[model samples]
Target: MKNTKVYASYRYPSQVISHAVWLYHRFTLSFKDIEELLAARGIIVSYETVRNWCLKFGN
Candidate 1:
């Protein structure tokens, strides 16, 4: 099998979430845009949290 990383090996959930948030925000999409997209897949995150995640990580 190919080598694959594991979630347990992840050092920061915030970092990953931040990355996703950045991608979501840098696009022309609205706040609710990414929020609903992720929520449809059961991410259970608020748009406010996503905004914060982007700000914290983007800096």
Candidate 2:
């Protein structure tokens, strides 16, 4: 199998990180917006964390 390297050292799972990043890029949403969206879904992540995920995973 091919090795997919994303979320290597992240505390959250790849799915969560991917969703947050996707939302930020796909909708051009702010990091705080993404964080609030996640919180509504019971994820409870900080905007800074979302920003970090974007920097790390975004193109």
Best by TM-score: 2
TM-score of each: 0.59, 0.87
Question: How much does candidate 2 score in TM-score?
Answer: 0.87
What does the lDDT come to for candidate 1? Answer: 0.62
In model 1, the runs with Cα more than 4 Å from the true position are 1-16
Weakest ten-residue segment in model 1 by summed lDDT? 1-10
lDDT digits (tens) for residues 1-59 of candidate 1 = 12223324534364457546676757787667778877887676777877766665455
Q: In model 2, which residue pairs have backbone atoms overlapping below 3 Å?
A: none
Q: What alpha-carbon RMSD in Å does predicted model 2 have with respect to the real structure?
A: 2.3
**lDDT minimum window of 10 residues, candidate 2:** 1-10
Candidate 1: residue pairs that collide: none
